[model samples]
Target: MTPQLLIFDVNETLLDLSPMKEGITKLLGNPNAYEDWFSILIQMAMVETLTDKYSDFGEIGAAALTMTSQKHSKSISEEDLKLTLHLIKELKPHPEVKEALEKLKSKGFRLVALTNGGRETLEQQMNYSGLESLFDGFYSVESVRKFKPHPDAYHHVLKKEKTSPEESMLVAAHAWDIAGAQQLGMQTAFIKRPGKFPYPKGKKPPLICKDFTELYMKLTVDA
Candidate 1:
């Protein structure tokens, strides 16, 4: 079935985080600290949800970077931390993203972005990446003070759009985000970005594309 609404996960799913990875690695003085910091950031987001506590995604990211520095026995100044994280606002969409999204929108898909980032951060990202006009709606987990993989985060978009889970499809690079939407009965598409994979034990995505170009082909020319 063709979905009426296409909900996108902003970070690695649409916008490339490689720029941030480069900045973070340089800041931490370790080539691999970026991955460590990101893993901790995601883990801590879930930790906030499970504990019924909320923090802005930006704050969590800063804290996660701190934790990574501590683990590596490196001292990071606050100024450098903020500067490194600021790269997120300057990220570019993956090379083929803009063109593919344009094609999808031409097909009458109701495109939207759902991110774990805070509203301000989401705005900065979209605006800087030149994708703000592409989406019909922009959503952040901050609206409900919950993170993705939490049912409420996915439900927020559904309720706002008056669309059923089955009538929507979530496109993401993260296995956990796909799993969250899957549990709610939404159609799922996994954009297999480099260094990203679906969970072995989770529900499989109905569509898996190498990039948004392939995704556009599958959802349109090949549908």
Candidate 2:
């Protein structure tokens, strides 16, 4: 099938969150706390998705941070929490992101975003990257108040594009996002950026790439 829609996942996938990770680690009084905190944050997001609850990503993030600090017996003030949240709002996109996005757009695929980020947060990220207009439309899980792997986030993008799952390709660096989209029968483009790996236990993606440029080259044929 030739996919007409291309959906992307923000954060670690497209938008680099390393700066936020560094800041968080420093705030937590441990150099690797950010890594542990991110793992816990993702786990909690899925818990919200599976158990049927609604909370913004930021709130969940704060909870995860608090848990991490507690486990490590570290103390952080409210000011530190505020600063961490602010840093998330200012993450930058990877170097190859802009050009790859442009190429995908020029190839005639309708680009869209399916983010766990709230709407305002997505706007901030896109605007900061100076590539906000590259997409045909944008969306956030804020509407459902549930994060990815729940299928709602992917379905949201499909509905907005008015394209069937088979006709839309989901591109993401995270295997969880790819797995979530694939569960809905959507074609998947796994961008194996650096240390990322395949979904632990779910329908695996159909295609894989080292970066967006690799995915872009293979996009000519679509699915």
Candidate 3:
């Protein structure tokens, strides 16, 4: 069935993260710095969720960056870390994002963004991307003090929107996010952005697209 609500994963899915990746790699003087830090950030976020604890996503990112630097035998100042990470708030949308979003909105689909980032940062990122006006709402997992892939995170959106799992679909580039929503019985779309892949062990997403334009095409037909 076609979904009534379309939930988007902001970072890396709608907005491109390559700029921030470049900044992070340059800061740490290591080509693998961004990937390493992101891996740690996700792991620590899950650690918080599993332990019934809460911490700001930005704080986790900073801590992860520090750990990555240390692992590389490099020392980074707090000032530099913050500066480099701030790049996240200035990301640009993927080339096809704006047009696709507009098309989806015109088709009367409720669009919302759900991210693990802090609320203030999520707002800044959206506004800065010039795609802010296209969404019906912007949500941060901060409200529930949990990160994505945790049922509470997804539930927060569904509860706030008053949309049922079966009536809503999650569109994201991350396999873990797709798996989480799929397990909850929500419709799922796996965005196959470059360097991202589907989870082989998870249930297959009903829609897998190379970008938002493709997603718009498939969703239009489905609707």
Candidate 4:
């Protein structure tokens, strides 16, 4: 079924995360450190939610950076941590993002962004990418004090949009995010970004496209 609303995940889905590679590699002294840092950040966010503790996504990210640095026996100064987190606000859209969004919008699909980033960070990132005007609405998990993969986060968006789970589809790069949406009864599309894959044990997403362009085609042409 064609969805009435397409809710997108902000980080790594619409925005390219390559901007963070330099800061992570410089701080951790490993070219592959970016992946490790991101994984830890998500893990900690889940930890905070599961433990019934609330922390801003940015705070969890900073703590994750510190933990990753210490795990590697590297010392990351506070300034360095701040700089690395700041890079998130400077991310650019993936090459095909603008065109794909335009096509989807022109076709009358309501577009919204749902992110784990706090409201301020989400605004900054969207403004930086110059894609803020394209969305009908933006949502942050901060209000719910939970991260993606948590049922409430997904439910909050459905409630706000007045769209039922079956009428909305979630498009995300993270396997966990897709799984969460799937469990909540929303159709899901996984953007197979570099080094990203679906969770092996979860319900499979109905659509797994290579990128935004592919996703647009799949939804418009194939669906």
- In order of appearance, the predictions have TM-scores of 0.98, 0.94, 0.98, 0.97
- Tens-digit lDDT track for model 1 on 106-204? 899999999999999999999999998999999999999999999999999999999999999999999999999999999999999988999999887
Q: Is candidate 1 or candidate 2 better by lDDT?
A: 1
Off by over 4 Å in 1: none
- The C-alpha stretches of model 4 lying farther than 4 A from their native spots are none
Better of 1 and 2 by TM-score: 1
- In the range 54-154, model 2's lDDT, one tens digit per residue, is 78888888999999889778888998888886898887788888898998888788888888878888898888878798988889999877789788887
Cα-based RMSD of the predictions, in order? Answer: 0.9, 1.7, 0.9, 1.1
Q: State, as a TM-score between 0 and 1, how close model 2 is to the true structure.
A: 0.94
Per-model clash counts, in order, read 0, 0, 0, 0
lDDT of each: 0.93, 0.84, 0.93, 0.92
Screening candidate 4 with a backbone cut-off below 3 angstroms (N, C-alpha, C), the clashing residue pairs are: none
Candidate 3 residue 75 C-alpha distance from true site, Å: 1.1
Structure candidate 2, residue pairs in collision: none
